[model samples]
Target: MTSFQDKAILAEHAIRGVLPPTPLQRNVHLSEAFGADIWLKREDLSPVRSYKLRGAFNAMRKVLAGDPGKADFVCASAGNHAQGVAYMCKYFQVKGTIFMPVTTPQQKIDKTRIFGGEHIEISLVGDYFDDTLRAAQAYCADIDGHFLSPFDDEDVIEGQATVAVEIEAQLGGMPDRIILPVGGGGLSAGVRSYVGDRCALTFVEPIGGACLLAALQAGGPVDLRKVDTFADGAAVGRIGVRTFDRLRDVSLVDMIQVSEDRLCITMLEMLNIEGVVLEPAGALAIDALKDLREQIAGKQVVCVASGGNFDFERLPEVKERAQRFAGLKKYFVLRMPQRPGALKEFLGILGPEDDISRFEYLKKSARNFGSVLIGLETKRAENFDALLSKLEAAGFTYTDITDDEILAQFLI
Candidate 1:
């Protein structure tokens, strides 16, 4: 059996042919506030803006090692993995076909193309990822090209373990605890395998895409009925079978599930207060620390901020979601009396600190009353209580749609 040190050395030799190790930076703000020495493994700062490149490099290298004559490879990914494979194709001078969902962002497609150059072919197929994956799989079978599994393959897992190897060497030793964000579990599995019993592990998964949570509950991998793609990087419907096998013995309690909205709050907090731009999935480890406050306090901890491929166009939506999750902003449907002075009367009842961000009449449902969607932003969360009390006192019938998913879909 190859020691983790040897595997890491081999990976280092492999990856140096591509890019340098991602930085492991001590987070002053988090360390100061959490009463612990906190560090961030900035995989987001990698060449692919993610650790996916590690797995892609390792897998492609091993494949070529086995059959140097073969030059064709294939993979399907909506984002990071596609770029990883494309970059590797360019590096190895191999021909590869990269399949991506038609709905994937142009930014990602452009990056993949720029990285692969003439070494890769980009195929835009199907609207959903599942469809694109099936298309890629079929195409691989038809052409006899090697298909790369994003997180399930052994070589890929070994490659991702390089993160742990670097972390140990860079930090001078293992941290007391390592909080990891689990999507399909490749990184977590790799780190756990490398760390062994050297350090404790806290695995965080998005509530909407809690594949790890579901797998633990069911005693094996099981498909989730639904997956919310807000945290697109971590929104996996099922944990990879190989990954779950590696993590089967981990205690269920060691895994934490964070709501998508709550993750948005942390992303916004890191960006606004700390000037750190974190994608929703990238904020998982930081957000997980909130749940383990007592356990991690005064302990040396490392949180892997997985990736920062955040689209700035989503910043406003992220801020709105964070505000709502924090209870500092709300949307409500108010049944207003269709009188000349009714809007003025309601406007006067609002607190000085409460600002009307959105006000739109939905439809006149009744002759006397009209339904209006109102969005309110406040300086403090407590101000919302005062506004609600004022509305009640004035006999204004209103329904808070801030937490109502169905209503918010159309109204908000």
Candidate 2:
């Protein structure tokens, strides 16, 4: 039997013929901020802009090598994994059928097409991922095509373990700690297996789609009632059974769940401050550093920046979420008296640094008072406190809807 390290080394050898090893660079800005030596394994720089292709390529190569006549592959993925499979299928000159949800963004669909070129076919089947997955499985069974699971298969896990192999090679040795983003547990499990307690490991997950955390808590894989799809790459509802078996021994204390809103803050920071474009899932490991400041201070730490498949069209939403998380922006419903001086009086209460980004009167028909939807932006978060205090002293009745998800969904 091949040892885990040998498998990883062999996988790396297989991958070297395709793409160069992704860069492992020390991030000076992050190092300065956290008072630690910070390095980022830039899997975002892969050919398909994610570490996913590593697994996809390795798995396909192994299968084709075993049965040279096998030529078809099938997979279900909404984003990165689909692109990975598509790219590999084209590289291997094999036919691939990719199943994706109807709701997948056009950007992803177009990228997948570009990666696969004429060698792959894409089917937009269901409104949700589960439906798409079932359709893919059924089609694979019908055609006798090899079904490539995104994270559940042994070969896929071995392929992903190549990431650890590259990290070790690039860094000369394992760092003090390695932070990983967990979705279905493929990458985390692979890296954990390869490292094998040589370095500390921390797993980060989006709070809304924490399948790994849930599985760890329940002592097995279990479906989450609901999952937030904001971090599409890591938004898995259930941990894979194979992956869970590998990760079942992981201590719950080592897992950290970051809020979706907080992830936005990290994404925006990486873009605006560091000039790095990271998708929501890509930001998980870096965002986790905020929670590990003390533990990693003055230590060498590596955070895997998983993928950079961000859609520029989502910039407005990303900025809005970041602003809301930082408390630099807020929305409110205010009841204003319908008097001549009412508008002026409310305007007068605004702080010098506060700017009105949105204003609309909901009920102009009400003679006594008007219901106003107001969005305020400020240079500093504390300015909102002063603005709110002034509004209260002025006897204006208002409801802060910035933190109200239900109201924000409908009204904001």
Candidate 3:
């Protein structure tokens, strides 16, 4: 039997050949905020800024030990896993062929190149990961190269189990509760396999792309009809079949789906208040606390901050989402008189704290009135109530299009 203890020992040995242990620090801010002893496993601080290297390192080491002639490796990934494989290829003195979606950020591609140096060759394939994966698999088969799956392989799971082993040692024992973010289910399955009833685990998934929840509901892996890529790291369309098999019996109650916008709020809070930088997936465990407030009260809880490969270009969208979730900002369509003082009169109803972030007047269908799109932002959410009341009293006919998905998508 491939027990967790065996994998833990192997991971210890394998990881030492690559990098030092990531930090496991108690988060005072989180503890105070949630009324629990909150600890963070900072896997984001790894050399590649992710826990993927552990799995790649362990798998390559074991494979080489068994057959040294199997030197070349292949895999497809759009982000962290690609970097992990590239770095491992350099460390193991093996050739690697990495396939990535063409739409992947330039920074990620450059970082992968830096890690792999001359040992890895990267090919940009189709715009989506599914297409890229198909290309990589076919290429690997044609060349008779060892195809390294990011999570499905038994070795990868055993390697990922190392995170659980380290958590146990670093915390001095199993924590009362463990919270993890799930994408393809690899990390969650592996860690849960190792922990094995020793700790209570809560799995968090992005609401828009909850592959694990779907798989659990279906009693097997099922592809999502659509995936929202806002939480890119955790926006997997389908959980890996093997990983899902390992996680099949997980209780539905233990799974929590967090809205992408809510995650943005948590990310901003962690950055602004706690001075922590976390990608969307990295913030999952911390954000999940809201749902588990009752269960984890006064208990020791550990949250895995999975990865920190955030791109600053997305910060504006993150801020916008956070503001919307907090109710401090809203977008709406307004009907206004086309007369000269109509616009000025509408603006007069605004509270001092309410700022017009967006204002656009569309063509007037009627001679006396026009349709206007307005975005309002305020320092406090309550400011909206006062602003709305003033508008109502002023007799300005308006419709709040903020919650209208089709309209918001087109205008907001």
Candidate 4:
């Protein structure tokens, strides 16, 4: 039997001419902040702007080589995977049927169309990914087409292992530590297998979509009740069975789960400070460094920035969430007296750094005990403490609704 390393080398050779090495550049901003020699494995710089193309290309080539008559391929994805398969279909001049959820953003749909060119057909399927996946599988079975799993297949894992192959070649060797973001476990499992025990590995996952953690606790793969898809690239409801088999022994200490709101701060920081635009999933490895500061300080570290396919239209929501996580922005319901000077009196208690970003009537505008919705932004997170104290001293009654998920979903 061929060894994993031998197979990875085969994949490396298969993709050598297709994907030139994605840059493994040392990131100055990240290095300074973390007090480490931080090198970024910029998979985001790939031709498709993500590492998914690597797996898609390798898997398709292998399938065609094994069975020449297999011309039809099908896949389901809301983001990078769909774009990847579509890209390879055009490359191989093969027919591909991609199924995307109805809720997929128009920008992603258009991009997938552009990549596949004349070789691929896209079907807008169900509203959710699971529904979309089932539909794609059934359609592929009906048409006698090959179904390309997004991550689970052995060939796909080998394809993703090519990332590790490049890291070794480009960086001269593995760094002291390599941080990888886990979704369905393809990239993390592949890299972990390739690197072996030579380097320390840290896995990052969005807290809301921590399938790997759940599997570890259960001692096997299991579906999550729900997944928060903000980090859509990493929002898998379950880990791939074949992939997780390679990753089952990873310690819980080796995994870091980050909140979605907290991840937005890192995305914004990388964009604003480093001029590097990263999607939420792409920022996971870098965000994990916050917890590993003492362990990784002064050590050579590599963080995989997995994808950069971020929509600029979501910027405002990202900024708002980031601010809320940092405690620099807050929302509250204020109960004001009916008197004319009541609003003026409430404004007087605010510190100089506190600025009202939103103020509106939640009830009748001039009615006694009118309810008002107020949003405040401050220069620092601590400024809210001083402002709230003033509200207490003045006998003003208000409810801090900054972290109220239910109310936020409806009103904010």
| TM-score versus the correct structure, for each prediction | 0.97, 0.98, 0.97, 0.98
Per-residue lDDT of candidate 4, residues 1-412 (tens digit): 9988789888988897687889999988889988999999998899888999988988899899999889999999989999999999998999999999999899999999999999999899998888999999999999999999989988888899988888888888878999999999999888888889999999999999999999999999999998999999999999999999999999999999999999999999999998999999999999999999999989999999999999999999999999999999999989887888988899899989999999988886465788889999999999988899999999888898989999988779
Write the residue-wise lDDT of candidate 1 on 48-120 in tens digits. Answer: 7888999999988989999997789999998888889998999999999999999988988999999899999
Candidate 4: segments with Cα more than 4 A from true spot: 364-367
Kindly report the root-mean-square deviation of model 4 from the true structure over all alpha carbons. 1.1
Candidate 4 is scored at a TM of: 0.98
Alpha-carbon runs more than 4 Å astray in model 2? none
User: Per-residue lDDT of 237-347 in model 3, one digit per residue for the tens?
Assistant: 999988988899999999999999999999999889988888999999999999998999999999999999898899999999989989999987788887899878987
Instruction: Name the candidate, 2 or 3, with the larger TM-score value.
Output: 2
Instruction: Give the clashing pairs for model 4.
Output: none
* Residue 48, model 2: Cα distance from true site in angstroms: 0.8
lDDT of each: 0.90, 0.93, 0.90, 0.92
Clashes of each: 0, 0, 0, 0
CA displacement after TM-score superposition, residue 206 of candidate 2 (Å): 0.3
Candidate 3 residue 318 Cα shift, in angstroms, is 0.3
Candidate 2 lDDT over 1-412, as tens digits, reads 8897899889999899899999999999999999999999999999998999988998999999999888999999989999999999989999999999999888899999999999999999999899999999999999999999999988899999998999999989999999999999899999998999899999999999999989988988999999999998899999999888889999977889998988999998899898999999999999999999999999999999999999999999998998999999999999999988999999999878999999988886476888999999999998987888889999999999999989999889
Off by over 4 Å in 3: none
